[model samples]
Target: MIDFFLAHQRNPHFTGRSSILKDLKGALTEGGPAVLIGPDGMGKSAIAEEHGRVNVTEYDFRLWVRAWDATVLATDYAGLAEPFGIPHQEDSDLQDLASSIRTWLEENERWLLVFDDAPSPEVLEEYLPRPGSGGGGVIITSKSPGWDGDFAKIEVGPLDPSEAASFLLSLTGQEDAEASKKLAEALESLPLALELAGAYIGWTGVPISKYLDIYRKRLGEISGRTSGLPEALVAVADISTEQVRAVSQEGIDLLRLSAFLAAEDLPLDLLVKTSALLADSVEMGLMALDRRGLVRRDEEPLSVHPLIQALAYSRLDDGERKTWADETVRAIGGAFSTYLGDLSTWPECARLLPHALASSEKVEDLRMGSEPASLLLNQVGLYLHRRGDLAGARNVLERLVVLDERFYGRGHPEVATDLNNLGSVLRVLGDLRAAKGCFERALAIEEAQDAPDRLKIAIRANNLGTVLRSLGDLTGALAAFERALAIDREAYGPNHLKTAIRLNNRGEVLQEMGDLDGAKESYQLAFRVFEQFLGPGHHYTQRARENLDSLSQSESD
Candidate 1:
């Protein structure tokens, strides 16, 4: 048995890849070539190196090449001359040496060649040995998912929890299962992250239990390794996005935007469509970033790792962070409107919802009062309210009120609008006093306006009356309802839908006050308006009809 050549030895600490090694062996035996494809730092290169280490005795000549790109692949091939003892002068043409090595590979049997971090299958095709000429095996590692039928594709994925925990315990030389499990889960059992965590602990001598606290405080430090550290983790990205930064700055811009949002299943369409940059440039930028494995551009959505987002975010200057945060808020706010919270817009709203909250949080954490954030929170509050998420609605509405006040002043109509919506959410949540307070503040703001908008005044009065009635303040409710009724009558005239809604609201208060005749008249008038304007089949019209029927039943009884 000949001693095979492998440039890097198998990692002494490599863990949990027996199944993958078996798959690699099977794939290499059956194929033109075997490619390990996945997101960057999922241990694709390590596995390939380990596969070579495991099969050392099976082959005569084994070559490990870091085929980063075409030029590097060629250089690696040329350098192979020295290892093979082929005569070559210092000024020998690299092409000639590569050609000679290609010839040698073609003529040999039981030989193995590995291209780690291959730039592309197209570039690699030029360097591989001719098919069916020799019993030689080849393996490749890449971030790209797409591969032609000529290669067998094996996916490198996250390590299982047990495997990850074991790796940590082994590396730290500790027997603490609980701490190891906690640490592994925090890192999501990602091999590269685990390796970095292990390396950090080994170097610092930090116990696994205390390591998590340090990790939280110094995330960038752990993700980007220390001096003289092996290159597994990165602070800015999985792969070098310097080219993306230089050429497709918009692509880097897209990544900056992604950093403030949810890390996984991020809607690709929203990011591309909402970007302020020209669509074509942004698209091209995304492709460039995708090619480098900086952004994991899957078929539907683009996902960023949490570590990627944290690093990208941490790298931004405060000014840059604010600009991008505001941009994110505007993107979500413009897409999500308070007017359309129906089934028609549900899917888009659902997709945009996480991003909206994420943006809101980012701005809030920075203590930056962005006016655009109010718009996003308002629509988010409304959507949550309509979706029967009352708690979520109240929480968002509360944030919106504070933001509106901060950005638009306490007496601004925007603040009134936020207060009104918050009151409605509070009312539904069974907090009558808090609901009444919100409604009262909203109405006071509206009434204090020098020339109040009549429609807005009516809405404020109407919401106040509803909440007042809920609090059992019949007299206060009646006055508020009358204020709304007078405003709507003068502003919209008698038969308008706005008057009808106010009339229906007044009717509810009158009935609660035991004024049967007044309540009946109001219901009849509301029913007439809804039937004439919205048609009898409309839910609002049917609701009024039901109001009348229930009132008649009460009178007959």
Candidate 2:
């Protein structure tokens, strides 16, 4: 006769984590306890629960408990008496009943017990089963870190980028790999948040590409009790917050400030740099946050999960949010070097660039102080332009223009500076007419000032000249260059590099306008200034010498 068989059903949405599962099973097979630990929302509980579900038939009895609090742990322990066949009455002493359950585990074999969402290893000691000759196994899920050396510990972290994207595609039936990858990254590869996003996509049929736009618009709503994400995620964040707050107020402050910055490898020293707080104080705060498993202290540059950042950001009041945003701006501006051509700034700029852009977005959205915003972002835009990311440069500069204009009026000198910087990017991006418009408006703004900033006007004019030259308006180009030269010659004198740049612009326009001797004279003066100021081996000097050689070649031909 054929035998009836049943299969252990698995969660269809669960994917990846094969390696972690292997480590867990290997640890469990030794007739020992295995611990799964990580930050909340990393899917530690899901992983542990999945392991239990699939191995139900392997043990004589299997049980799960939620042990997030002492009361819950006590009640769950007492409630497990019947499962292990221990006799108990409703009115019996709960402590005796729990001890009875523990005794049963000491006596019995082939039983597996799971402690899910354990508050800590200390709180968990009372309820844990002692392995007997019968050889039972144990599993635990927790956000607490540093399990004792006795238990086998498995760490669950964010999913790999590919696996996370695949999970979304599988769950939502989305066929686009790029969109899936984008969504996965935006969610920062956290499992519960990914599940929430995938569920939202499936429920609404919103294209994954459009989901982030909607998410940014509703970040506050989604992070709160009224959420696009499920309540569990918010609960996890709030619980974690309370845990950190209990141990360290400075940690809570740092976490809040972190919410307003980029959600990636934040330098460990940033809290001290931005807050002017003592390093030891910040170190203690970080250690406190780390022990609670709210932040990872092991990573070189500390990281906060993007979802954690979003939730923390949503918890802030408007005024408090603005204050954090200001702090972020100050930090970025203090370190972000604006000298676009300087190589020394590149490493630090690359490190801080992501945070700078994040801070810029926040400052613009809040309409907070634009001066600080510009201080950080102007360098960000310039650095991008220098690095050949014209589109990125344009995006950064455009944000600054809107922010500075709104905060300081259209005609403010700051507005002109933003316009001039943006114009440079637009010019490089092949939007000559748009660049011309930007430059003209900037020049007008600088020219209109009661006490004109001549150096500023010179910058505006020099940029205006190049766009005009690109547009074939050599006459207009020459006039603009001439104005720039006169200002620089007075302010910085004929020997300065600024005066040299104006002379080069002037020579180029003169050559184009068919005045060879005029061009030669201008080039010679610019070449001398470039050679003396920039050194003979500098690229600026080489280019200047090349220009002089070009004029001689024209005469030779």
Candidate 3:
């Protein structure tokens, strides 16, 4: 590989694929099976063949077979055996072929078998090692993510921003940083797409943006023969799908559905929930697709290449696109409604929020049932914090705060409602100190706003008191809880259900302060409120009963 690159030195035009070579190095040194999965024209084959030749340099034997061979010639054993100096026997039966190749492979101490553009699983499965035959490490490159082996699965995504820029500038003969950045952005940060655009620009002498506009208008044209290169990009996408379809039509549909997803990654649960297929079936099908290189597996989600997304979008006519968009919105609304309170459901809601907002009649229209849109956004912040997406969550919550203020007024109960929610997210993000400040600020805002709704004020006071308790300011927590209790009692009378919630909150604060007797009294009051308003067997009423018994027993002891 070094000699080849050195021989072609002066052609600094090879861009965005340096990492592919690096991965090849890691895989070869590790000495096991590896599957190189990437989109078309991103140089998967070039890196595999070149690096395999370089690394297995001193091996007793090396074998390379195009994946297409299995589809065409039914098997590659005869061709691969030649390198090991094994001659094909005339009138050899299937048993003879398997025995012959197994013996040859087992004999070689450090052999490398490179399967280039391997056939679909349907064709390749017939030729996969019978038990105990695949003794040595093998490397396979295909358009899809293949199965897990004892080795690694190196998925080659598009180039990082810097690599994409360097590649584009080198190819277009343009050294300007600004021009390259524009081109890179326009090409959607895809390596092959950028390379093709660069070749077109250099050949035609057109400006980068001009070509980008053409890309937007007619992306299909860019993949065809022109600029002295083969239509490699389109050919790769189509051929990979054709191969996948040969094995599983359902897998192809999964890939197509992946293209419909707006986010870069889709979680496993979302896949099962949104798709028509059963969870286990979808999981296996997607895993197969991952092996084939049509889709990729991220840590907790799966991704399709940007170029594949573009191609998928292009394939949809206007009506079909609209239908997909509308159906997606409806799915999102349903998910948000069912799973709003639970934190585990946040990612599902977050993934659906954008599509819902874009296609739904209005944001307000989607905020129905248990999980209203405003509360859904608040939950999104919590999930974002758990995922270490503080900046993103903060951005969304800040905008949500503004929306809340505009719709419900700065001091209105609805606005104060989200203020406490936002503060909770901020606290978990390691700013509990700052979060305490936000709660206090909201309390002040709520107190100043002239609303006749004392229940709203009680809610604000209770929430602020809770924040104070979490911040370890027990004295402040007690005072705020007392104020909330007083307001609730004045507005709804002592035994009202709302007052019971305030009593439970105050009991929690009293418990924090080590006042067991006061906490017991507070819990007793809350239990009575529940018994009167909610009756027995209700979830919250049961919770109140448990708290009362626990607090009373603690006081007795």
Clashing pairs in 1: none
lDDT leader? 1
Q: What is the C-alpha lDDT of each candidate?
A: 0.75, 0.74, 0.59
Error of 1 at 547 (Å): 5.1
Estimate the overall C-alpha local distance difference test score of candidate 3. 0.59
Q: In model 2, where do residues sit more than 4 Å from their true spots? A: 1-224, 276-280, 337-345, 490-500, 524-557
Which pairs clash in model 3?
Answer: 143-293, 144-291, 144-292, 144-293, 144-294, 145-290, 145-291, 145-292, 145-293, 146-291
Off by over 4 Å in 1: 1-190, 194-251, 277-279, 282-293, 337-343, 527-557
The TM-score between candidate 2 and the true structure equals: 0.57
Candidate 2 local lDDT, 1-557, one digit each (tens): 11001111243678889899899999988766798988767877567667766676777766666565454455456667766667865434556777788877778766777786776778777677654334677788877786885688888889999999998888777788898898788777878767766755664577878876655445454455533444445543454466567767788887887776765557546546655432346766787665444554444657665566777787888988888888778777877776656676666676676677777888888877667887787777776666555666787888888888887899999889889888988997799999999999999998899999988888899999999999999999999999999999999888999899899889988988889899989989998988887899988788778878888898899
**lDDT head-to-head 1 vs 3, winner:** 1
- What digit string (tens of lDDT, one per residue) describes model 3 on residues 39-134? 665656556656645564545555655454331222344445445556653323333554567676655556666665664445445444443444
- Number of residue pairs clashing in candidate 2, backbone atoms closer than 3 angstroms, sequence gap of 3 or more or interchain: 0
Candidate 3 stretches greater than 4 Å from native: 1-191, 194-395, 402-415, 427-431, 508-518, 530-557
